[model samples]
Target: MEYISFARLIEAVYLPQIIYTVIALTLSCMSSHRSSTSTELLTAATVQVSSDNQSPNSGNPENTYSDIISSSVHNITVIGVYMVIFAIAGNLMCSYFSGDACTIISTYLEIGGGVPVLYSMDISTKIKTALILSLTAFGGLSALFQSRDMIRISGLSFIKYTTGKIVCAFLCFIFYMMCL
Candidate 1:
């Protein structure tokens, strides 16, 4: 059996994720900073109108706080609905497939559930390693679902983030192949 050191395992598992996260965060911060200037200007104009009108409710901190809380709850409800729908669809698909195909689909749906499946597969070590690294980089559909709220709140483009994940997965696969 081939033995892998702890450092190597950590590098393989975390290096690509860290690299992708750093790049994504940098891009997100730059874009948000640019957009925040415009948003701040618009907000200032609106706030000035509320102040000039001398509306008690408009300036009430408690009302504003409640509004923010309600909006957050709405957003969370929407995300939860999306997650439920996705889970249902994934379950239906998984039920439709059998054996290896089902395992592969499950892997793309939920990484945690799929890892044991991967371990039990009678596949070559290289294929297993590549799949593990690439899947970890891509983070599966569950990760996408979990990150949807964060992506929306951050004002980051979903398409770009997904593309980055694909690129990172490819890079991880390449890195693994190179190490062999």
Candidate 2:
């Protein structure tokens, strides 16, 4: 049995994820047609609150804060519910397939299946690694659904979403080839 070190796993897996997250965020910000104006309101409120202890809402600022916090919590809960349902349904659909087909289905649902599938394959480790990396780059159907739900309020088109996924997958394959 091959024993992989923790550092190797971090270097190969965690570091790539961090890099991908940074790149994804940079791309998202660059691609957005309109930037959020909400930050201006928050900055103004912070300046005002800091400038005066005698502010009119000094006694009720906590109430306002609590309202914001409560709303954020509610939004998180709703999103969590949606993700759970999506994962459950995807897993159920994947359960019907076996061997490589099962691996592909599970990977389509989430990237978590990639490692197991890679291990199960009789192919060379290098190819297995590439497959896992490619699967991660695809971001799975579950991720696509989540993205759709999140962007529902932003008027993002389905065509754009699919195009982005295709571009990402292509980049991932290139990255895998470079690594190999």
Model 2, residue 62: distance off in Å is 4.1
lDDT of 2 by residue, 58-143 (tens): 57979768777986897778657656765676667667656666655565565454457566878666656656665666666666
Best by lDDT: 1
Clash count, one per candidate: 0, 0
Model 1 lDDT tens row, 56-174? 67768898788779878987887666556656666677788777667666676666655666777887777777777777877877678778766754545577777887778777877
RMSD of candidate 2 to true structure, Å: 7.4
Weakest 10 consecutive residues of candidate 2 by summed lDDT:
32-41
Would you list the clashing residue pairs of candidate 2?
none
- The local distance difference test score of each candidate is 0.71, 0.60
What TM-score do all the candidates reach, one by one?
0.59, 0.53
